[model samples]
Target: MTRSMCRTRRAGKSAGVVAAALMALAACSSSSDSSSHRATGSAPELSGTVTVFAAASLKESFTALGREFQRQHPGTKVTFSFNGSDSLAAGINAGAPADVFAAASPKTMAVVTDKKSTAGTPATFVRNQLEIATVPGNPHKLSALKDLTASGLKVVLCDRTVPCGAAAEKALAAGKVRLTPVSYEQDVKGALAKVELKEADAALVYKTDVRSAHGKVEGVEFPESARAVNDYPIALLKNAPNAAAAKAFIALVRSAEGQKVLTGAGFLKP
Candidate 1:
């Protein structure tokens, strides 16, 4: 063949190969686009806010759980109001709007259920026992529930209506130890604060609270605590503004991952 004709044929072959490569690239791009669209539509889209009224003791674990819930359900937010269980129940009964309620004790949870503030049966997620929270380094060397009775020692207790208070009362009575506290706080965290701030030598609180406090306070476990183990109950509020998100939150709390977080924070599995 002539040299020019040979060169022309080679150029045509290269052009044809380039055209085939472009068509293959276009086909793959079209397939990927369709798959991306289907995946986007199939994935559940959750948005809005879920308000949770939880006990003071659950602040740490529930807060972590809420964050993980938000991670799994992007565009959703979890807002929590942590307080004394009895106080939260009263607020719910008084028509405070909340998507979920988690109480430190079943007795306190009953307050909300009795008022018909819950949609279904409350599930026990975890349990806690009373422990003495003392100032870091145990300045008073408070050993047991009875140690709070030492004269000149300023002790704080939870109010009779609070879950921690109720448990503390039961444990004290079981031990037959009677001592007047200098102050009666409304929530477990308040009682812990007294010890943390050095306002009180010791306070009866949940184990989880002491754990949450890190180095601010130290926990001293007592055998009498066995007499009043508190069960933490959670339920979906009636007519929750974000019912779907609330349900998802509760499911996460009951799921293995949630239990892992709770147990890591020193909560006993229910």
Candidate 2:
């Protein structure tokens, strides 16, 4: 073969080799980038149920949040036990199968934390102030904490052990008003229910509870509520059966979307 032809053939082979190497490198880089993307974008899959014990006043907001959490994690379910914060704390201390505990006050959360029943420090997520829930239309014109003490008014209150009841007591004291309810309910919902059912003329309950009532009762705000706002704390239980999901749920509760829902339901920001 001629030297010129030989050189041209060698050059062609060299160019082919270079092109192959470049293609191979490009493939490798693409594969590496794809792997990195998967590593960074993919998260561990979470499943199973996360049981939450929360104060009754959180019923509306929390239920909405729970539904959102389940929607975000298709395989997970959020079950809630809504009651008085004190009662829920007692249940946790008694070994209730709970994954999370959301109390209306730090004092009630302490009932569990004091026993080391939580995985980490509890975080305050929201605050709630007191309101007088009167029968719809303010029939008796009950406007303030003192108004609840009027003679012959059937007033209802949450039991003093619960956060709502405790806050009510503080508000009453702050107003320097004395009140004796016809009955003391176990949770804020129960107290609100008394007014809704017309079983009581008025009930001292959380503003959130009154808002959730949706015109079933009329809410009367008093200045004393500022002094008695209750801080709500949430924690993952130490023995949570579904810790992964529980932690995610807690994260959702503190997220901006969660705060929007809570604030819309009349809960105060923490």
lDDT of 2 by residue, 176-224 (tens): 9997789999988888888889999998888877877767988888899
**Clashes in model 2: which pairs?**
none
C-alpha TM-scores of all predictions: 0.83, 0.84
Candidate 1 local lDDT, residue 160: 89
lDDT, model 2: 0.81
lDDT (tens digit, per residue) of candidate 1 on 1-270: 233332211122322332333333233334455456558896345689999999998887787778767766668999999999888888888888999999998888888888663556899999998889888888788787788889899989999889889998999999999999999999998999998989888999988888788778888999999999999999998879988889889988887556656766778999
- The global C-alpha lDDT for each of the candidates, from Candidate 1 onward, is 0.81, 0.81
Q: By how many angstroms RMSD does model 2 differ from the true structure?
A: 18.2
